[model samples]
Target: MYCRNCGNEVSEKAIMCVACGTPPLAGNRYCPNCKAETSPDAGICIRCGVGLINTSNHSEFDWLTTLLLCLFLGTFGIHRFYTKSIGIGIVQLLTLGGCGLWTLIDFIMIVVGNFRDGNGKVVVNKQRA
Candidate 1:
């Protein structure tokens, strides 16, 4: 992969670009997939035909916190709220977590690391609360 900000080659798992001191996907000046120069407003890379996504602003939600919320306050949809799933949270809140069945399923999903946030990004597996 390439850093979108500086067109520098970077590892796929790199959090930030070493050359530019910025998140690897932060800029639209270059294509992260092919290192091709791209327009700032372009949505997809012309050379590689890959969608350009700016993931620099994405927040890494803690997996442990979500698990704890689901275990302790899932009846109130607290875990859904923490994951920014407000609509589902409201539904869970009104239904009392589908009479506790939905909460149990959510607990299992979180434990198995299949839970996702509002943006469909997986929760970070950090031990922090």
Candidate 2:
């Protein structure tokens, strides 16, 4: 593998670039597969034609924060709001917290990874990853 940030060769399991100290897959400057220079906005590598994968592993969703919101402010759908699902949040709020049942279900969903963020990526345990 190669560091997309600096075109430096990197181990497949390396999360950050040793050369640049950035997440190995965070940048769009070079193709991860071919190490060919590329446009930042390019969807596919010109040389390898492989779809570039984002390297940054940051999650937009905060599991602990979401759980707290669901437990304390669930009636107002504050957790949904935090996750950028404003429409669902509004529905939960208007429904009097989905009669409380919806809130409970949402909590369970979050715990089991059924719930996703705006970016459609699963929330992970950062320490474990």
Candidate 3:
């Protein structure tokens, strides 16, 4: 494999690139299959026809933390605030979580991994990269 950030050769199992000091798949500058320079917006490598990994969509929010916040502070929209959804957070806060119904629904969504961040990406269960 190759480092997507630096186009350097790397082990497939390697978590971080030695040359770039970033996760091997954490970038879009190069194709991991052929080490060819890739356009930032390209979804697939023109040279290798491999699907490009989209690191940007990776969630920055922790699932467990969001779940806890939803369970305890959801009435105040703390989880939405943590996920950077300030507009919704404010609305939720002002409405008191839609009279608590919205808060309950959000808590269920978090528990079932259906909640998303401000970017519309699913909240990740793992630690941030």
Q: Global lDDT of each model?
A: 0.84, 0.80, 0.86
- Tens digits of per-residue lDDT for model 3 on 87-120? 9999999999998999999888877767888888
Displacement of the residue 87 alpha carbon in candidate 3, Å: 1.7
The candidate scoring highest on lDDT is 3
lDDT of 1 at 47: 91
Lowest summed-lDDT stretch of 10 residues in model 2?
A: 52-61
**Between which residue pairs do clashes occur in model 1?**
none
Whole-model alpha-carbon lDDT for candidate 2: 0.80
Give residue 65's error in model 1 in angstroms: 0.5
Q: Of 2 and 3, which scores higher on lDDT?
A: 3
Q: Which residue pairs of candidate 2 clash?
A: 25-55
How big is the positional error of residue 110 in model 3, measured in Å on the Cα after superposition? Answer: 2.3
Error of 1 at 60 (Å): 1.6
Candidate 1: lDDT over CA atoms?
Answer: 0.84
